[model samples]
Target: MAEERQRIRVEFAYDGGPYHGWAKQPGLPTVQAALEDALAMIIRQPIATVVAGRTDAGVHANQQVVHADIPADIWATVPRNAPLAPAPAMLRRLNGVLAKDHPGIIVHQIQEVPRVFDARFSAVRREYSYQIADGLARWNPLYRHIRWQHREELNVEHMNIGAQDLLGLHDFLSFCRPRPHSTTIRTLEELSFSRLPDGAIKARIIADAFCHNMVRALIAACVQVGAGQRPPAWLGERLAAAERTSETKLAPAHGLVLEKVSYPSCEQWAARAEQTRARRDS
Candidate 1:
């Protein structure tokens, strides 16, 4: 009999310090490779996964979503009538194996979904936050992996002002690493900065999708403003310039976190995926 298949959505968290990135690569550690290997061992079949956000090396995620098609036979092993939901059982099994085999990753969510659920394309928006501690008050060595410790004096007010102009839909080519055959236009929904209780400055950015290095470049531009090297209007002018320039640097990847990915209701997942895959001009 042909193998039966059921689509499953999985959410997990990772430190990203011990692996390359979310994508699998030869001769290097990756989140996907580890998860796929564990799932294949449990299910007795090779498995592949699609992620909601493909984070860069050294980037962390509090809740990263993934989707995979598992063999129905393997999924049936979990108790269905013993008062344990298959979803939670699978979550536990996955986490159990992950904790034993992978030292830095954890699986948190798993649910059977309609076959139309595409983790990447179905996502409506993704939120990213960057932490920087220029004031020294929030620069703690304990969180060296999660936070950026910038010793420079940063004007938070100017950084916030510079970020405000980035709001709305625009072709953000000037801030993205160029990719062939990929459009640089994006709907930048939010870019706000606030002083945390720890005295660190954090930037929260939400967007439909981001081109490679877009967030870091935007942060670098804001940092320049915060450091008094650039004016508020300079960033807007760069947006209009529409070309990636050396003026904006790429912030360290370690400071960025994939906070979350929003999606439409389960009933509309297929439709939402379809809408996301369509090309955009505005």
Candidate 2:
């Protein structure tokens, strides 16, 4: 008989500057490759992980989620030395292995989860934040990797006004990079802008799921409105068009961060995953 398996849920964060992206790619360093390699080293077997959200290159993740399945017996052996539990042992061991090479990625938490818990389909919402240092005064070399340096000062009020029109369920094809067999229809739960104490403008975006380039493109369009280059109503018009336009540019990926991914209670995991899968398939 095949060995019984256990599903593990992992919560982690990474600085995406050093990696290609979250997905593993041939001959290129990626967050997934680094993570899987570390996990394999500890487990003494190859391991694959499914991420909650696949971020683009240069996009950081403050809190990313993933789930993996491994042999239950092997998992029990993780805490070989100290009195630590398997989950904590795996966390320390993986971080130790990663620190030797991939220090930018950190595993914050790990636990055995129900088989029904899927990192991707079980997720109810994903939150992202973008930072912009508009004007020279707000620019800081220390945060260059995390914040976008914009030439023009942005009007937070205008950005908020423009963002309101993009909220709710709609086809965001104009903002998303087209992908085969993927849907651009998304429910944007929240989109708002505010200025930080340090004078940097921050954008918070929450959605059920995002298509490729959707968040950055939305940022670019709203920034134009904030900078007075486009009228606030132009954002609504773009959504109505349902097609990509040259005017809608993609913001730099570095400014975007995946802040959180929320899931329902354990009992609801299976139902949520099934619902999401059915929606995607339809």
Candidate 3:
């Protein structure tokens, strides 16, 4: 009989500046490829991972999640002579490998999880933050990789007002790049803007799921209103249109970061995944 496999969940963070994206592609360095390569070295076999969110190139992640299945015997060999548990040993070894060749990625946690715990489908929500350094904010060259430097001064109040119109269930076609067989309908739980102490503007976006380019597109729309180029009401009109237009623009990918991915309790994992799958199928 084939050896039983154990499902493992890993929480990690990465600077996406050097990689193409999360998904592995031939002739391209990617977060997934780098991580899987590290895993394969330790396990002596190939491994694949399913991520919570497939962030685009130049988009960073403060905390990202993924799940992979490993053969039981291979997992048992992780801590050959060490006193550490398999999970902790695996984390240390993985980080050690990554540090040598892929220093931009770091593994925060690794644990054996229930078979039903899916990093992607079982997720309850994903939260993202976008940083903007407008004309009023002092330009910091050190943060160039993470902040969008805009020439125009932004009005935080106007951005907040425009963001309010995007809350709740809506077809965000105008704010999303269309993908084959994927729906643009998303329930935006929260969208807010605030000025940081450094005079830069920060946007916090929470949603059940976001389509291709959704977060950046939404930010671009709010930036327009905040810069006095459009009225706050224009956001609502864009949602109502349910179609992409020339006016739709995308904020720089470097300014965005995947902050977190929330999931239900252990007992609800399977149920949540089932529900999410059904909704997507419809």
What are the candidates' C-alpha RMSDs?
2.1, 0.9, 1.0
Q: Candidate 2's residue-wise lDDT over 1-282, tens digit each? A: 977999999999999999898999999999999999999998888999999999999999999999999999899899998799999999999999999999999999998999999999999999999999999989999989999999899888988988899999999999999788888899999999998999999999999999999999999999999999998888999998999878779999999999999999999999999999998877
Tens digits of per-residue lDDT for model 3 on 156-259? 89889878889999999999998898888899999999988988889999999999999999999999999999999999999999999898999999999999
TM-score of each: 0.94, 0.98, 0.98
Clashing pairs in 2: none
Error (Å) of candidate 3 at residue 204 is 0.4
Compose the digit string of candidate 1's lDDT tens values, residues 141-179.
Answer: 987887778878799898888888888999999898867
- Give, for candidate 2, the lowest lDDT window spanning 10 residues: 176-185
Better of 1 and 3 by TM-score: 3
Q: What does candidate 2 score on TM?
A: 0.98
Cα error, candidate 2, residue 159 (Å): 1.0
Residue 216 lDDT in model 2?
A: 98
User: Model-by-model lDDT, in order?
Assistant: 0.87, 0.94, 0.94
Segments in model 2 whose C-alpha atoms lie over 4 Å from true places: none
After superposing candidate 3 on the true structure, give the runs of residues whose Cα lies further than 4 Å from its correct spot: none
Better of 1 and 2 by TM-score: 2
